[model samples]
Target chain A: MLIGFVWLSLTKAGVPLDFSFLKDFSKRLGDGFWLTVALSLASLACSLLIGVACAAGQSAKILPLRYLCNIYVGLIRGTPLIMQIYLFFYIVGTAWGIENRFAAGVIILSVFEGAYITEIIRGSLLSIEAAQIEAAKAVGFTGRQTVRYVVLPQMVARTLPALTGQFASIIKDSSLLSIIAVTELTQTIREISATNFRLFECYFTLGVLYLCLTLPISFVSKWLERRYDYGN
Target chain B: MEIEFRSLSKQFEDHKDVLLPMDFAGDVHALAVIGPSGGGKSTLLRILGGLIAPTAGQVWIGGEKVCYEGAAVEAHRKKIGYVFQLGGLFKHMSAIDNIVTPLIRVHGFSKEQARARADELLGRFGLLTEANKKPAALSGGQQQRVAIARAISAKPKLLLLDEPTSALDPEYTTEVLGIIRELKEERLDFVIVTHEMGFARHACEKVLFLAEGQLLEYGDSDTIFQQPATYKLRSFLGKLLEWNI
Candidate 1:
């Protein structure tokens, strides 16, 4: 009833409940939407790589490497993600003189998501019993080989659900890239609302689009989770 | 075929010496270490498995000094198979996959070959029906079988089991012990740390009684059980005999 009342009030106030702006916004948000997807996909890939590497480093036997990884995780996790994005954007564009907002956006998202992924991966790695490592070692596996083959396969399998959820989070968080004017879906909706004075419609359409993208991811993640649940 | 430990001692910073200085040499195919809890039997097994270093000693596997200070112990571990007290099957893998993991990963067998070998091993262990089942779905005995199958898949010369059947019910324990006994007939060398004196007496060629991390007695099973040489061994046997009876 509350949602209906709100919808009626907005429609009666000439807020334009129709999704006609989607077509117009699609034209303006075209290249930017593709760029956003590209940036998100690229960033997700890089973050996964960084996260796995960091997790491995954290789990490493060497003291310095583990300490460094711990510090990295702590710093990233302690601060707000918005601050991290702003810091990375400013550092990359001004200090590093990287003119491409696309590059800056990708780098920012990758590092931001990488920190969270590292924790998830580390948790997954440590979830494995120490006995498994011993068994692998006993079977002629060097430490490196044991981790690469025995530990990693199990880790990836165990953490796939959490990792995919993290990936979806990265995609949603890509909206923050609009601060630097990367013109992703959120930015496109904002531009459309500003031009057509249809804030409600624009946001609703954007929400639908996000739902479309993320709902499948949620379902796929759930399915993958079931499939990969080897313990069951 | 031979293992020699010279003045082996393991001391943790927090605890007293877990393994007291001990010298032992053996050429037997199957040796069982039996002792009460906190006897450092697992520590001794780990040292033999090359998972840890001894504080002051050397472990020679087949006459090669494998556990010297600052040595790459992993090389020595290549010749041994160590099963933990639990089955320690990889939770994320099916029984077949768990059996073949080390084979494909460490031995570099092709995927097809590894699968076939894993099937053969699991089939031999009566786990073919549960090949696709994960460790969580399998019974404790089944998981232990998978672990043993995985351990022996690499065909190591020496097998080290730390209380392999301690976690199982009597029936499952018997099943696992029967499998180990069968493996022994294949000429696989074994060092089993067990609480089951009956299995030890029947399956092991020799038994080493450990007390407070010290070797109290080392002899053939008949001699160790029937005529313990030391006071500690006598008391340990007395306790076990009372429990069993």
Candidate 2:
């Protein structure tokens, strides 16, 4: 009801709502949508690997390794993703010969998202009560066994929902990669609007398409939280 | 099990001394450590379990000095079981798996052996039907019972309980206390930190009254409850039992 009212009012106010351009651009938009999904999935996998490693490093006994993880998280979180993307792609990426825009975008998104994932994992691990670890020790579990049985299970239960929700953030954040001309959903919309001058229609369709990707992920996140709602 | 604390003290980096210097020794099947909050009862129990190293002195259990360094500490921990106030069962695992996994993984029991042992403990504790439930599905009392069962499943020589029933309602407290009392019949040695005055007096053979990081009174259960040597003990017991039914 609200969306109909808003769309009708905007159309009556001379905001052209011509979605006819979609017929011509439908195939490109579809490809862009799939590209975003693929990018998010690949980054999700990479970020999880990076996040787990960094989280473990943050808790390592070696001071330098712990410091390195702290510094990585601190730097990523302290700066904006846009700035990081620009600097990493233009400066670090070029210097390191990471030339493929798609690969560069994946690397940037993974690094950016990995820091947050690391915090999600570390926070979950920390939330596992000291009593739990102590109980494992009391039962003669080696440090590895304790982590494997007690720490990891509880951590996964605690972090999985948050981590799943983060995929939505990844999909949305991947839109920013359009600035570097990655030809993702947002970039495709930006290109279509530039040619057709249907900025409102194009952006609205973009929002709807992004929601199409994210809403189900949001549902899955909620479902995971309910499924893993163990002894809180 | 026998316990000895020789100038055993624990001071955090902030210099708050949780346990003051103390020297005491007792050999008993059931020893209860009772104290007011922040009185170092839990810390003393942790030291005995080899969970933490005391700052200054030494602990001896079963005639062997408890080592807190390297492989020796792990060895010391292997022979001891501990139950926490929160039950501390792995929340994600079913009750039976909580007991079985540790037996198989840490104690090197074969899967069959671990399953059989877990089943035996679950049956003995009357938790056979709830064996498939996770800790979240169990009651406070049942969770603590599972924790106790898991603690003893590997047949540790000593079990240290840190106020196992403190978080429970009266009914659950009774349920958990009953299980602890039954441990005595099995001849499994245990040191429990408790606020249950009656259990300390009746179920345990020895009592150590601690207050403000000091062992204010130590004696056989009957003697300590009946003839507290210090005013501290007398008043502590009086305040704790003032409104008892």
Candidate 3:
């Protein structure tokens, strides 16, 4: 009710809440929407791999490995995603021969988000009690068995909610890939607005489309939080 | 079980001695270490359990010198069962899985074999109905019982229980102590660090009284409680029993 009232007032106040471009540009919008979903999923999988390795590396006995993980997390978290996207795409991508925009976008997004996932995993790992580890040890659990039976189960419950929430950030962050002409949802909307001069309608529709993807993700994250709570 | 501490000591990074240089020997089925807090009871237990390496000393259990070296320490730990005060059941798993998982993963039991063992143990402990419940869903007594079951599932030569009933209420404490008493009846050798002086006196054969990181007294449970030699033990016992109902 409140959202409808706000939309009605905005339309009356000359905001031009026109969505007529939906008729002709719907197919392109749908394609862009699906692309964003694919990019987010592909990035999620890659980032998860990077996240787990780096999280383990953060506690590695080798000093250089620990320092390298620390530096990666610090550098990524300390800088802006836009700066990273530009530098990686232009300089590193060219040198590495990563010219495909979609592939480049996935790599960039994965690298950008992997730092956050690393922290999430590390935090969950640390949250496991020392006594639990000791108990496992006392019972003859090999270090690997302790990790497999004791640490990982608790980690999944602790990290599932944060990981799903990170997926939402990935979807929103993938929009910045439009700057490099990856032709995702935001880029598609920008092109439609540039041709038809329907900036408000195009951006508004883009938000609703992104919402259509991320809103369900948010609900799923909340549901997972409850589902995996296990009374811990 | 025969245990001998050859100058066993533990000092943390802050240079604080958690367990001062100590020498003691005992051969008993159930040995209880009772003392005030910060008296190094748990530290001594951990060192025996191979959960922590001692600063400068050796522990010999059952004619084998406890080794602190890499593979030797793992081998030492594999033959001992240790239970904590809080009953550290893996919270994510059900009570049955909590037992079965360690049996299958750590002890290399087949899935069917592990489940059968878990079921029999849970039933023996009167927890068969609650086997499927998670630790958080079970009572404090049940959780500790499951921890004990998991601890003994591999048939260790010795058990180290570090105040296993301390975290429980009076009713639940009795429920757990009952199980520990049963372990005594079965002649399973174990060491317990407990504040329950009554259980220590009654169920335990030998008692070691520790205070301020030192072994103040160590002797038979009957003689120690009835006739404490050290002033610290008397005063400790005095204060403990002073508020008893």
User: Which candidate ranks first by DockQ, i.e. highest?
Assistant: 3
Q: Model 2 segments beyond 4 Å from truth?
A: A14-23, A53-75, A91-98, A196-201
Compute the lDDT of residue A97 as modeled in candidate 1: 90
For B5-107, candidate 3 gives per-residue lDDT tens digits of 8888999999999998999888968999999999999999989988889999888999899998777888888788888888478888899998898788777
DockQ of each: 0.49, 0.69, 0.73
* TM-score, first chain, each model: 0.87, 0.94, 0.95
Candidate 1 lDDT over residue span A1-232, tens digit each: 9779978887788664676656755676666567667888999999989998998898799999999989988998888878977877787568879878888888888888899999888888678877777666666677687778767888878788888888778878998888878878788778778888877777777777777777888888898899888653
Candidate 3 is graded, for docking, as medium
Assess each prediction's global lDDT (C-alpha) against the native: 0.83, 0.91, 0.91
Q: Alpha carbon lDDT of residue A183, candidate 2?
A: 91
**iRMSD for each candidate structure, in the order shown:** 2.3, 1.3, 1.4
What are the RMSDs of all candidates, in order? 3.4, 2.7, 2.2
| Residues B1-245, model 2: lDDT tens digits | 77787988999899999988999988868999997899999999888888889999988888999889877988888888889998588878999998898888878999999999999999998999999999989999999999999999999999889999999999999989998899898899998999998999999999998999998888899999999988888888899888878
**Model 3 misplaced regions, further than 4 Å:** A14-20, A62-65, A90-98
Name the regions of candidate 1 deviating beyond 4 angstroms. Answer: A1-16, A56-72, A84-92, B13-15, B61-75, B104-117, B185-187, B243-245
Tens digits of per-residue lDDT for model 3, A73-114: 999999999999999999999999999999999999999899
